[model samples]
Target: MSGGQTQEQTPEAGTTETTPKRLPAAGRGGGGPHFNVGMPGEKSMNFLPSAKRLLGRLRPYRAHLMGIVTLAVFSVGFSVIGPKILGMATDLIFSGVVGQQLPPGTTLDQAVAQARAAGNDTFADMLASMDVIPGVGIDFTRLAQVLALALVLFVASSLLSWWQGYLLNDVVQRAILRLRADVEEKLHRLPLPYFDKQPRGELLSRVTNDIDNIAQSLQQTLSQLLSSLLTVVGVLTMMFVISPLLAVIALVAVPLSVVVTKQIAKRSQRQFIAQWQHTGALNGQIEEAFTGHELVKVFGRQREIEATFATKNDELFKASFGAQFISGIIMPSMMFIGNLSYVAIAVVGGLRVASGAMSLGDVQAFIQYSRQFTQPLTQVASMANLLQSGVASAERVFAVLDAQEQSPDPAEPARVTNPHGRVEFEQVSFRYEPDKPLIEDLSLVAEPGHTVAIVGPTGAGKTTLVNLVMRFYELDAGRITLDGVDITTMRRDELRGEIGMVLQDTWLFGGTIRDNIAYGDPGASEEEIVAAAKATFVDRFVRSLPDGYDTVIDEEGSNVSAGEKQLITIARAFLSNPSLLILDEATSSVDTRTEVLLQHAMAALRADRTSFVIAHRLSTIRDADLILVMESGRIVEQGTHSELLAAEGAYHRLYHAQFTQPVAEADGGDAESDVVGASAVTGTLRPRSPVG
Candidate 1:
């Protein structure tokens, strides 16, 4: 509705091309022409900055985040200590078993010395390290105590981990909630021109899909990352406390795992970027195809649209497959390295136990710690892909949040108090682009309660003239005034509140007929709604339906005819009862009979209100108090219909072109005959009442 073009022709500048071009294969980073609106070009994946900013969103919940971290530490700490306590149980049983083999009342040291004398040094050394008394056999009492302690530790760890997960969920949800609100507010603040440069579907993807992905990634990664990191630290500390030698061996695999994860993540990150980009592009294609489905069928371009969809879908598939395949390599690679470390730890640990350099229970506990250390490392490696994908999505969403917003409303806005609807444009110049000037040095005025009709060929700046008055765009130079006050000084809402517009393109949300009409004046009573509808002829057709005013309009309003939709929109404008009215091809879709009826209705509605009418049909504006003919953004002629006819200028030629009939000369022949000839070709029009 805020486009730079007139109703009938392309704007001189900033014309959008709506043809799809084949993009380069995924990961190649080659951009292509978009189908409807321009797709944002590929950007370099800045992982750290984007990830940091995304996490920064949670700064408001820092206290809850800290609590979650503390819980994770305690949870992992208890779990890490469990294996050591179980190892003490193992020691109790082993000492009892060895003591049972010794003679009654024999000391452990004496037994070890006797075995050493028999040249069994390894067995003796193992015996010397055990805390066994002679004739003792598997002390089940002490073993049960140790087992109970281990069980308590494990259960406590489980409870803490569950509580940590619960808290993390809350923190993540609150952070995402704030983020969603920010994005919604950002969308409304963006200028209309910003939307012109972006496809709706692509923008929707950033707001919906990308943000959803970010939420999921944060939820999954943050909780697991916290627990896994704490587990790694706790397990490593326990491993060293048991056997520093084995801990060093387990850590030998860490650098290798790091290298593997880093290499694979680098490759997968680029693929993820490509994947989401293609996803947005494909969504844009689908949206365009569906929106213009009927038009495509009319033009027989279904096959072309299908082919384009297939191409984009294939690109998304390639990007998705590559990302998954590359990232999938990380888990197995890390596990393989961990297994190598396990083997080395086991071999060295077994030797230490055999030689009694370490107790069998200590060696056993160290092996368990070695496994725990590798497990969290593997988890971290596996989660790298999720983190990469999420960060990619965050960058996309951040782009929207960072987009330049429109100029803010004035701090102290001017109020009209009582609007008269006298509109004036003085020395105004505007262009969609800097080099291509569409409207220049334009000046015009409409007195209060006057109907000013603008007639022009396509691209003649007809629609643009009204757009300026509404301040849909800021002027390059000069100013427009409403009731002698500069429109720029007034808040956009206040200025637009005084005006009602009915464009050629009618938009109706999914709702009942009454609801759609009520959108113009949300507080309007039902009686008022019916009056507006009846005046605009919407009531006549609506009553034909079984449900009448309550009949639901589909999302696309496909149930109604084009003329019916136009009528409903006109009713909406009428209900607003603004001081000023703008009708751009408002009756273009209606039939000749309906147009005649609407013209009369509009004439009555225009009473006591300044109205601007942009019409391509010459007959509709014949009775207008002032008719302006614009060409190439300049006013070529201005006069009443009969006055313009007498001038024999651009309007005279345009009039003849429409009727394709010769008319008597104003000076030489009867003017009444000319009026009759014109009325014969076009339908008769009601005489306009003199402006008060």
Candidate 2:
């Protein structure tokens, strides 16, 4: 409404592609397109402050996170000890064997046994004793001490790892649990237009598949990543201490691998983003097919649907393989580079030791450090896809969460007490699209205990009026008054509470029939619910069900017929006992028998309340009240059926063409029969008293 556009039928929403149409960041880090590389997605590109806001959720659980960090440190600390001890063993065995070929005061067999025993000591003890005496030959006791501590560290690593898993599981699961609930609540609170814009599959992906990614990434993959990182750090530190030259030489592989990894990961990230989008499109196709299966079968579009699915499925498969193939190449390549680095170190360090420039112990420690550095790097490189994919999913989620909310009602809201059901449209006009008013300068009034029937073509804005009555969409001009109080000033929830609406589509959740009858009015007693059901004629057929009121209804009430679904909706409206009732195509799809029953039920529901009926059947509301015959967006004629028929105007032509079907002569002579499709009233009309 704020924009100057004459008509904006499909308004773009949320942080959409508003930038100067970024020409898909040239293939592979500006490599001029031949390399077939993909650009990094919005992850490292966008600034989403809402994500930073969501991080506040982690604050309360900081203590638990700190503990996880400590446990990880301890676990890595223990894990690194094993390799360090092996290096010490190597050094002790190599030193003991050189020149002397054993330890002091011992034969070959005795010296070998003593050296082996010394290699088993704690490395710390070995270092301490070595510091005490320069050039001391060998000590089997120190080696023994290092080996014993290494064994203890290995066992401790295992214990700490188990604890890490247990605690991480509890924390991540609970975090996701809270997050899911919060998201669901937000979904409920968001405006209806938001749902209309987003595809059902995309929304479903957020609730289902997207959350699943978060769980896997945070729970298992993240733990592996963290531990691997720590392992790399610990090994690198020790390697540097052993020999800075070797440490620097071995790390050539690390930076090179990271550069390569970043390139490959970018491609993989794009592929994964494509994969998720394609998956959603595929799911959308499937859902659309299933929902409209009846129409599809009737129209014989099964082959067409299948072809659509196959095309989407192929795209999904290609995306999946492309992403996995790139990500999969990283680890093995890292390992290859790692092996080459090891060979380089083995050659270079062997010479340094032989020349007595570096100790054999130092060379061993350098190799140990190399593994520590390489391992976590490899692990991180491999996890690049998961991390990026998670970010892609986050972007989609934030897109939803960041959408502008519905406009709120005035702070000083008006209230209607024991409303008389009198409604007046005071110069009311609405435009879902700007300047293309659906209901232009529309004005009408419904008196208490009177029926106001609106008859119009499919897109004539008939349903829009009903929606406005319920305040589902705000009006663009003028005010709608309920019992002389401005509807806009009233709290939306309160305003809706006084109106009962029967929509074209009848929705039922998975629950007992009784439960659905009391859906919004859950405080109602079963007896009251049954009474309402009977009043709506739902009780008539529900009694025939296997379990009657207790029947376990499937979600969407899929187990029921269109007629029964309609009756259920009517029953729900009856239970509400609102002051104003609206029926939009209430019995459009029902058979004559069900329509009659629905008519009677609606009569009961409308008793002592003003009602608005968007009808296609003239026989349903022929007894009395006014009819507003709509053409395009305006009310062209208004009057009772007989008066309009007598006047021979728009209502008359419509009545003859759609509603006035000849029926078997009743006791009062000829009568009009009910028919849904033939209920069209002409677009033009003659003037008459607007109300019966």
Candidate 3:
């Protein structure tokens, strides 16, 4: 089942149940990391993973990332040099004052003339040699030199911007693509049972939303961190070299900022983790509604659905708001601290300048450097919130990637060849949970081309038996065999290829009817598809439609009637032409007329095909080669209809009591009763139960 977006994807996008020729092995899909088994909710978490571990994905593009880093460094260097030149100009301007030294143009010639009138020979003589130049007049070349350095720094800064932007963007995109593919592949590898505990929305969030956050983190992490670090270091160097006193004062507030940052980051990280979990729950509610809308309507659960959805929706809102709120405060708080430090540095620098202990230029330069130092520190602190979220997201992603495969399967899968329809259950047993076994000491055999029928009440392990044959769940004891070979030894794909199944619940993909039929036999020709359709009674209904086989069905074949869906699935099986077939309640939903038609069609298709029927109506399976009656995970009795009826045991009582009941039909006619007045035998009959 899918949403409105399903229209865009392939109709057969969901299940890969098909007749793919068995390969030597199944690909784990990608060579990327698995995020399952132990990561997110696991006991063993690698919280402090090595730098090497974090950089694993970037290893392939090491050269490219290095180029980006280099550009970032160059860009920061240029930007950092701008303030230095400004400070140098300031120093040069004031150094000549206090009679420190004359740098050609510092003292105006007019001022020197006044000093000469006052008999100040040193100042006047220094001004006499000053050569006038354009722009600032005397000594224009030195001023030009300062402006040229500024231009060089500006150009370097721009180039660094372009390079870092391009490189970081490319790296982030590639990383995200690989991560998506890996997550998708791992989802496919996960066993069906794993789905029983996990919700679809949570899984989707890990792949789509959470991984996206991680990608964003990767995008900013390298360029911003490297540049910020370099800027901080450069600023600190300038501050220390200019005036150690002011530098010491500027450093005072850093520890306080670090402490506050750590506290905020911890809160943000926790909130982010909660946000993802709540989002998944909300998504699951939506998915469940869309998939089971019809069931909801049938059960008259509109109010219940709304209540459930609203609860999850509220939880998501609170969690997301909390996360954003906490993350939002980090930047302002960091800026506040930086501003406070700025005021302190300015006040302390002013005193040093007033006492003549430092040049006004040195005081100004120290204040400028102090600001430069705080800027990067503020940024790194603010961005730390986003980075923390990356950690939480990575934790979920790694959980799925780390799951262990069910069993030790060959790296190169071995394919089965020329399978016969023969199957035997050799004292097989199974249990999904330790306390409750679904099947026990079950033994049976179906020879080639034989039709075996199993009938029982619900929970009788009826469905569990067929699942064992398919190895959907592992066997707890004993073994099952196909053509005298241990079934597990033959590769899952090869063995599954030889078996065809028609489930009671019809799930169709979005596609033309012909494509749907071909899904069972990927190579089936149009002729084979049509023939199979005719054999399964789907052709009769299909031909009546204007488009016939060309008609497209909605997802899960929701466009068709239930019986039509069942017949189409049956057609799929017929097209596959597998030697063995499992008809799991094929007639459960259809009216008696359609049931009768399906029965005849099934009979014709079963010729030369080994078939197993999990039948509900006793009369429908009377002629089966063998009948099995199961109870409480054990087969209580089995025989031909007459033989079981004569025995008057568990099977005899269950069949006649459950299947023999009759009532007037739509035409007000009495149907022939299946029971020979034997419902009273061994109390009421318990219909054959589905295998666990």
Q: Compose the digit string of candidate 3's lDDT tens values, residues 1-692.
A: 10001111111112222211111101111111111111123133344572235558777888888888788878887887787686656555543332333334444556567667988776455445333221242234665687688888988898887888888889878877887898788877776455433445557777787888888887777667878898887778777877888888889878988998888877776677777766755665566566666766887877888987787788778878888888888788888888898898888777665554665556676777777788788889877766766766777787778755456455665454555578899999886566666678889988877788887765566766776788666788999887777877766777788889887766678999888888999888888888988887788889988899999998767678888888888889888878788887777667778888778888877777678888656667887888888877788887788888899987776664454442222223333233322333213333454999
The C-alpha TM-scores of every prediction are 0.90, 0.83, 0.81
Candidate 2, residue 43: Cα displacement in angstroms equals 11
Q: Candidate 1 lDDT (Cα, whole model)?
A: 0.83
- Report the number of backbone clashes for model 3: 35
TM-score of 1: 0.90
Q: Which residue window of length 10 is worst by lDDT in model 2?
A: 19-28
What's the CA error at residue 615 for candidate 3, in Å?
A: 2.8
Q: Against the unseen true structure, what C-alpha lDDT does each candidate score? A: 0.83, 0.70, 0.69
- Give residue 366's error in model 1 in angstroms: 1.8
lDDT of 2 by residue, 3-32 (tens): 101111323323232211111111111111
> Per-residue lDDT tens digits of candidate 1, residues 190-269?
86566655666788889889889998999999988988888898898888888888888899999988888998999998
Residue 336 lDDT (model 1): 91
lDDT over C-alpha atoms for residue 511 of model 1? 96
User: How many residue pairs collide in each prediction?
Assistant: 0, 18, 35
Task: Give the range of the ten consecutive residues with the poorest summed lDDT in model 3.
Answer: 1-10
